[model samples]
Target: MDKDTKRDLHSLPKTLAELVGKHIVAAGLLVDEDPERAYKHAAYARRKASRLPTVREASGIAAYTVGKWQEALSDLRAARRMSGRDTFLAIMADCERGLGRPERALEITNDPAAKDLDADERIELRIVAAGARRDMGDVKAALAELQVPELKERRARPYVARLFYAYADVLEELGRKEDAREYFARASSVDREGVTDADERLAAIEGVELVDSDVEDGVVWTDVEEEADEAAAEAEATASRERRDDKGRDHRRDDRRDDRRGGREDRG
Candidate 1:
């Protein structure tokens, strides 16, 4: 390997712990995309500095993303033990959700300890908590938690998307088809250029054929529907065999009656 090619990447920090912390922060941002990779980076960071709250929090988030619920909980516990701060409470709540303990997440969001958080932090906490509440079939509670005027008036696209999606999901679950459709459409329109997933969904909701799937009977059939073709072929073969057997039985009955008639005629 060329020494020049092995040059320092990302401007190595003066301190080894700082370099690890920076890597952990970078890995935390990748939880939604490359969870496994994020977990590896987070684990590396924690190995370098186990007492760092930020590293443990990043590990918790990455573990949650990769479906390691117990590991996530352990990381978050270590983070809280080290700092006693709520820097990553939202992600911790997400861990609880992944672990099938959404109610516990909700309880943490509602805890009095969250009252001292800043405006932005408060909103994030509420959103995370509401997600848990929504998962537990408490639509009203989730909506109530987010109905504050401050949050409603905010113009953050990501937050708006979260609110819209949560509201739409609740309405849809409650059989309020029109309301849910309207909210979903609103969410879809927040980004109209199709540069994001929300925009694509908006195009879909507005009757635009963006993906070429024709929906029928509340189900969509796509280009890769070979599984259905196999099942249909098997059904048709079974039906064909049944019909052939029925026809053979009818022919045999007709021949037996003809033989009986011939016997009677000979006797006469």
Candidate 2:
């Protein structure tokens, strides 16, 4: 490639600041499962929209997954400032907790600005706050943070799982082994199909199994049905072989009887 081609590629329209919002969204979606790749994409998006809050948020998420805690704190805080009261605040609290400053994390979540977080985001914040309190040796306060009203409702299984999982940690910390095991079991029940490390924690507590749900986005039902049908056909083919073996045993029995009858007739 020549210098002119490189310059043109670098100057592409999609690389421009004005058109980076959608790419930022895409970068966020990729961060959890593919952080390294997501980080590269987020970097490109940030180059185009460094001032955009979502761009910075995506960068922070990717960096956090890669264990770049300081970078995550900086980018997430910047995103929180630029976005002016976005979900990035809760995310930044998580970064604080990750860096072993749970008290600061709790303070961040309690900010009046964070009070209006949605159900899922609120639950997430509480989980982090609970951990921070636990780290601070406040076991009761940690459990209290996870005891929100929504946790008792079946419709809030995901949130409830998060609560139980966090509660289990506090229980374990306080040397309440049996209670911790029960809480861990409860967490496992609700966290099925989860991709997070909470599942592993639940398993360690006892009598819990992690069953991953395979729900792929953008995959067609028709394709799934075709795959199922193919599997069924293979199963049927195996059954057919078993039936043929049974038939071979019956044929051998019939041949043996005929030979015995013929020999008896010849003796007579």
Candidate 3:
């Protein structure tokens, strides 16, 4: 367990802590192989110890794996509120995307502490940010959002397979089939563990299902957004300012373009 998680669990009574700890361990172990079971374990842990931030975090991740968008979002938000450390910003943004509210996903990525994400987290955030653009029906802008220097690196970095896969997916959407094929090939080469269906995509055997999340801005608004922001605000109070997420979403030009289409805020 991570130090913060250990510390959080330490405050619980011994018997409850042991029970929660067992479920947490099981969830982590099965999350990759049997996410449904993992979610059950994590959910049980959360039910037993809803006040524990770590348990909530685990539950949120487990639910996210199973595509329970609203449940994941709510638990993650609770985790952030209880811990005052918002490490799941990217996940929360993805949950917004899963919930078909990509604009809100983009807005979540604009939190001041966004720049404090570590490398892998930054990449995840960038992916979600690009996905939000795609969801808004701006394929060109979506491509621009993923214009990070790491895209060119030869050395393997974490999440590089997913990065290549996302880029290829966008290229396919824009009718650049050749470019998409190239990226899918690259993704397949790196994805030894088959995290994505890049192999099937490269073989042209996978069904091409295009999901559209195009909605006019200002047409969709949730009353609960304010509460989420307030929770994030409280989280920012405890986030260490010393850390920095080296990558910034390199999409200023995208924002300029989006401004003409719709008023969307830009962040570094």
Candidate 4:
């Protein structure tokens, strides 16, 4: 847990705090790989301490990962009300979009609390806002919404790559193919950590298709373990063949020796 979350759990009895912390840790560890299980862990923590903002925030994230949009919105609302933090502004808006309420998402993006968010959060909100506009079929408005000074940022922050990607997508929607490709290239250049699909998008614009070689021809990808097992099977088969050959040669030699011994006895 971070210091801020530890501070949030300070009000609980030590034993209760430890239990909640364990569940939170488990939820975090599983959220990306096993979202349903992660949500269950967060739900367990929430049942124990529903009033804590930290628990509610964790539950919100887990719920979001599992596409439980309404539940995610409820948890995030409770967390914000409890802590008065605007940290989840972008995610709350996204949950609104996920719930098929793009207008509500736009409303969240326009919320007065948006001003208090850090640079990264603010940019994420803009991205969600653009998505909401696109969802509402106002593609031009979506394009306009992404036209911010931060779009020109030279610094390679996570949000900068995302912003460039969002802008490129909007430009593509507006039929500005060249402009879209340019921004996609910019996004790919700054996305050193593969946080976005900007590289693939740029490749697509250049008439290139990016494919995973292992997934070609509808074949399932195999791991190193399967390859190793195949190698071991081949080695065992070679050894077994050698053993059979040696046994066959030894039996033939023994028969020849027996035949020679019979001939000598007959001659005597």
Best by lDDT: 4
Query: What's the TM-score of every candidate structure?
Result: 0.61, 0.63, 0.71, 0.77
Q: What value of lDDT does candidate 4 attain over all alpha carbons? A: 0.91
List the global CA lDDT of all models: 0.69, 0.72, 0.83, 0.91
User: In candidate 2, what are the lDDT values of residues 1-268, reduced to their tens digit?
Assistant: 2232233334446546334544555666777777887788777777765665666777788888887888888988887786574576667788888888887888887888666877778878888888788778888988888778875645426767777777777888878988887777677667655623554565556544444456663112233455678899999999999999999999999999999999999999
Sorted by TM-score (best first), the order is 4, 3, 2, 1
**Cα error, candidate 3, residue 89 (Å):** 1.3
Clashing pairs in 1: none
Question: Candidate 2: where are CA atoms >4 Å away?
Answer: 1-26, 195-268
Q: How many residue pairs clash in each candidate?
A: 0, 0, 1, 0
In candidate 3, stretches whose alpha carbon ends up further than 4 angstroms from where it belongs are 205-268
Q: Write down the TM-score for model 2.
A: 0.63
lDDT of 2: 0.72
Using TM-score as the measure, the top candidate is: 4
Write candidate 4's Cα lDDT for 29-110 as tens digits: 9998999999999999999999999999999999999999999999999999999898999999999999999999999999
1 versus 4: better TM-score goes to: 4
Better of 1 and 3 by lDDT: 3
Question: What RMSD does each model have against the real structure?
Answer: 9.9, 10.8, 28.2, 11.1
Q: Which portions of model 1 show Cα errors greater than 4 Å? A: 1-15, 18-32, 154-156, 191-208, 211-268
